[model samples]
Target: MLVDSYGRRIRKLRVSLTDQCNLRCHYCMPINAEFMEVNRYLTPKEYGEIIAELVTLGLEEVRLTGGEPLLRQALPEILTTISRCSLKKISLTTNGILLHRYLELLQQHHILDLNISLDSLKPEIFTQITHGRNLSQIQTNITLAKQQGFRIKINTVMMRGVNDLELFNFVEYAKSENIEIRFLELMRIGQACQQQQDQFIPAQELIDRLKTRYTLQAQAMPLDSTAFNFITECGARIGFIASESQPFCGHCSRWRLSADGILRACLLKTDGLEIRELNHEQRLAAYEQLLGMKPYLRPMEVTHLMHQIGG
Candidate 1:
């Protein structure tokens, strides 16, 4: 295993395939955010080479993330290429707008695990949060994905007063759909900083609410996992990523790679080692530098936004 100086074995890598997306989510991307040029990001072959190397270095899971991974034109090809890597698990984190367009391609590539962003179930509120008009389409595609044997995991960023009222609604939806749902605490980074202070909601609040009505059985999850998993009374699996109220940095065993090849040791940190132009030996040295600099815990303040850091 690739153990850092801090003794955290780095086994999972979150690779941002593209820093572009179709929707302008309020908490993730800024309304006027400038995206990286397409050519500036690594190509599929380059990603394959790097990922293959990482896999050999004890990387067990690869999760392709993006501003919206599905928006990348070469997504199918990219998935197909990365599928060649000797990794235990492969997944994608997407906004789910273009999921239907890539459903067949995904199945062809055998990429099944999906962590989809769905902040709201109400049409108007969904539009308000995502600045997109495809809530119904997203819902349809989610259903389709489930029908096609994909393990669906819905990720909801809970903002106070914005969609906190829909907490029970989301729980009910997850229960009815028989899908795992995780409520994420709104981190004070990037576009989220521009949001009103009242908009921020702690994961503890939701945990308290859920506990009031149901029995929450604490369950074990993967290492460096951000979420605290629980099995609810209604058989719906639920989780909370309380990064703000209760930091889980001590157990963090993963790292993030941006589209342009910046290696972020921690999401709360802005400065990172850029490995886009590095050679093999140089890249390995840079990785060591990042691991050496990895903090034991995140600081009180965070300035980088979700999209900028690769959510």
Candidate 2:
């Protein structure tokens, strides 16, 4: 087993398929973003090899991420490769814009757990946050995925002046749809760092606000879980990823592999071990090095963007 000095066991791996995304969310990307050359991304075969090795080293779950994973042309092939490994669960994080095109294929690969990013329910607000106009289509896709028996989780980054007023709206949606909605605090990373102060909202504040209307019972989660979850009086589930106010770094058991095959032990750290050019034995050594590099607490700031670090 890959255990760090702090005794945190590495059990999950997050892989970025590409740095390309269709929507230019202000917090995640710049208005005019330039993507890496296609050749710089790790190919499906390379991903399969690395993932197979990581599984042997004690990785039980793999989550595919991206600037937008669905934008990758070879995503189906990548999914097929990952499905061949021995894993307890396989998941993907996407914006839900292209989910309709790959729903059947994802089910075929047994990727039933999905994290969809949706900031707002209103058309204008959604476009303002994401700089895209697919609110209606994404909502339809979420419903379709639910009907198809997929476990869906909605991720919303709560910005104070932006969409903080929609907290109750999201809670009601969660109750009506019987799905989990996770509100994430704005982090000091990349383009988001510039607006973190003006937009940040602490998780405690959100919880206090919810207590006014509903009773929330704390839910038990894995020690390594990032979100602190709760069940509402109405039976709806809600969660908070309060990376800023309530950090979970001591229990973090995951490592990230960027699209370019750089392995990062901490999201806030800018430097990582590049293993794309390493052989099997060398890659194993690199993993060992990374395990020792894991920090016991969250860093004050991260120079890389969430997408660059495979959020």
Candidate 3:
């Protein structure tokens, strides 16, 4: 097991299957940059092996992320492998474009936690922010996912001038559908890094605005959600990821694995130990090195694309 400077045991692992994504969001990229090439990605087998080892090292929760995980053909295979492992929970954080196509396989594997990236309820705004994605398809997929009886979450990146007004609209929409909505304070990274200082709005303001129309409050963890700890006065709840506003670095029980096999101490850390370069024996030694790493500092921000980190 690996313990950081704060004595937090790293257990949650976010595994990036590939840096390639089908949609291009401005916050995630410039909306015209290229995706990771095929050869640069990790194969299903290699990733599974890493997770199997990671589980042995006290990793209990695993999230399958990608620019779009479903874009990869062997995605279901990877899901099944992770589900079969001793990890307590296995979930997927996706853009939801390809979810409807494989909802059954997901349910069959008992991988129910699904987080979808949806910034706007309006189609035009969706297209503008995500470059070329169709808003109608995402809406339809969200509806279908709920009807299918899967635990679903809508992850919204709260941009100041961009989608701030949509906040209340988004909450009303989630409340109507009875789905958990998370208002995330956008993290500045990569091409979106510069915009962080300009675009980021603290979660406190979002809750203040929502309180005008609703009597909601931030809920505690484990009971509310591992991802979102909340309970609403209206009998519904919303999640606010205050990564920048109120850093959870102390209790941050998570780590990220780049698609190419880099074990990042934190997304903001410019450097990481590359486990993929080592042999089997060396890989075990590498895991030990991870035990010596410091707690992820909040100001130490991620430099790569969100897709590259498996957003």
Candidate 4:
């Protein structure tokens, strides 16, 4: 098994296909920063090559993410290539705006698992969270995806009373719809910090709410994960990704590849080696070096938003 300096086996890679997003969520979207210049970003070809190499080094799983992955036209070819390599799993986390249009193409290319980010169940709340995007369209897209028989995971960030009280509503919806829900703890970052409480809710608090009924087991329990993944008594799966309350740094085996090809050593570490800027040999050597960076037990407060860092 390929291991990082922390002794955490590197098995999964989350690749950010693009930095440009169709919607501007209040939390993740930068207020006034210039986006990555199109010419400066890595194209699908270069990304695929890096993924191929990473797979040889123990990449057992790959999740194609983006500001919205469906924005890229070359993604079908990219997914097709990775799926053909027989990776254990290949999934995409999309906003679901463009999913309806690409549903068939996604299945055709062997991309099955999908993790969609949806924070609100109420239409007005959806509008509030997503900044004016039509909730009805997203709802239609999700319903259509379900009918098409996709292995879907809905990722919702718990914001205090905003979406927290409605958690079980989503859980019930998932149960009725035969879908899975992953309630994530809001991390401190970009637009996330603007909330009075930073809108940061701890994972245990959510699980405690769950404990009122279901027997929950924390998967890959790292203290930092505050993101506990659990299965219900009747076999329904509900997960929590506690990135802040409990730091899962020691067992963090995942690495993120940004649109510009930067290898983030830690989710909180913004500066790491950039693959595009390195020669082939130097790139490999630098990758090895990053895998050898000192592991932190007490991690610093994270400043990068998940969208920017491909969380």
Candidate 5:
């Protein structure tokens, strides 16, 4: 098992398929973001082999992420490779622009748990935030996925004076759809650092605002869960990924693998260990070294963009 100095065993792995995305969310990357060359990313077979190796080392769950995972052309092949592993669960995080196109393929591989990023319910606001014009389509896809029995979670980056006004709207949607909605506080990483001071919203502030209209009962979750979940009186499930307001580094059992094969133990760390060419034994050794490097406390900031590190 890959255990850190703090005794936190790594059980979850997030693999970034590529650093290319269709939408340009300001907090994640610049509108004119320069992406890495396609040739630099680990091939589908390489990703599969790395994930298979990690599974043997106690990685139970794998979450495929990216600048936008759906944008990767080799996704089907990658999924086919990973489906051959002995993982307990395989989930996906996407912007949902092209999700409708791959629903069938995802289901074929048993990847039903999905975390879809949706910052605004209003089309104009969504376009304003993401520089994309497909809010209606994304909403339709969300509904379609739900109807198809996919466990869906809506991930929203809660920013002050930006989308904070729509907090109750998100709660209502969650209640009506009977889905989980997670509000993430903006982090001071990459391009987001410029606006973090002005846009960051505390999870407690949101909870206080929510308490005025709904009674939220704290829900018990696994120790390794990044989100602190709660259920409303109206049967709505909500969660707060309070990275800034309330850090959860103590029980963090997750690590990330960038599309180009760098292993990161913490989101806020600037450095990572590259393991692209490592054999099984060499990769195992690299995993141990990375685990030892895991920080006991969350760092104040990071130089890397969310896309670069596989958010």
Candidate 6:
């Protein structure tokens, strides 16, 4: 088992399969974002081997992420390969644009959770935020996934004047649809930093306001989770990722593996341990060195694009 300098046991890994995405959400990046060449990404077999090796080092959970992970054609094969590993759980974080297309594949592989990124419920605002017209498609997919009994979580980025007004809508939707909704603080990362100073709303502020409308009872958090969850009197589960106003660095145990194979020890840090072309033994050695590089605290500022950093 790999433990960091702070004695935080490293157990979860979030891997970005590709940096390509279909949506250009205002908080993520500009519409015409340029990504790395396809050949630069690790092959399906390579990624499988990497996950397998990490599991041998005490990695317990794995999340497949991307600018939009479903954009990768080999994802099913990749998931199939990793499912054979002795990992405790596997999940996917996506924009939900192509989720319906891969429903069967995800179910067949028994992916434990689906963290869908949906910032707005209003069609017009959703279009404005994502710069895409696939709101209907994504909603349809969400509905279908829920009907099929998938463990679904909606991840919403709360940008001040942009989508913060929809907090009630999100809560109502969660209650009506029987889903979990998480509100994430807008990190000052890459293009998101371009947002007006007034646009970044802390998650705690929203939580405080939510307390007025409903009874919020705090729930015990899972070991690898960063969100603080509250179960409402009405049985609605809401969560907050207070990375800005309240940093959870002391208990953070996950590390990110970028599509190009960089081991990110901190989300706000610009540099990370690169593992792109290393052999199996060399990669393990590099991971050992990377453990020591994990800082006890993050700067609470982001210097890289959130999408490229394996959200």
TM-score to true structure, per model: 0.96, 0.99, 0.93, 0.89, 0.98, 0.97
Tell me which of candidates 4 and 6 scores higher on TM-score: 6
Model 6 bad stretches (over 4 Å): none
Candidate 4 local accuracy as lDDT? 0.75
Model 3 C-alpha lDDT per residue in residues 115-216, reported as the tens digit of each score: 998999888788888886578888899899999898898999999988999988888888888898988888877877888888899988987887788876
Model 6 gets an lDDT of 0.87
Q: In terms of lDDT, which candidate is stronger, 2 or 6? A: 2
C-alpha lDDT score of every prediction, in listed order: 0.86, 0.93, 0.79, 0.75, 0.92, 0.87
Report the C-alpha lDDT of model 4 over 1-311, residue by residue, as the tens digit: 45765577777777888777777777777545356776766776677677777778887888888878788767776676666665788889998888888998888876778888899988878767777566678778888988988888889988986777897788787777778788887766656766726477888888888788778764565542334667776666788776777677776777788887888767677677788866667877877887876356735456666577775
Measured by lDDT, the strongest candidate is: 2
User: How many collisions per candidate?
Assistant: 2, 0, 2, 11, 0, 1
RMSD of 6: 1.2
Residue runs of model 4 more than 4 Å from their true location after superposition: 31-33, 84-86, 196-198, 213-227, 233-235
lDDT of 6 by residue, 40-101 (tens): 88887888888889888999998899989999877877888889998899999988888888
Candidate 2 weakest lDDT stretch, 10 residues: 302-311
Best of the two (2, 6) by TM-score: 2
Worst 10 residues of 1 by lDDT: 300-309
- Ranking 5 against 6 by lDDT, winner: 5
Minimum summed lDDT over a 10-residue window in model 4 is located at 218-227
For 42-157, candidate 2 gives per-residue lDDT tens digits of: 99999999999999989999999998999999998999999999999999999999999999999999999999999999899999998999999999999999999999999999
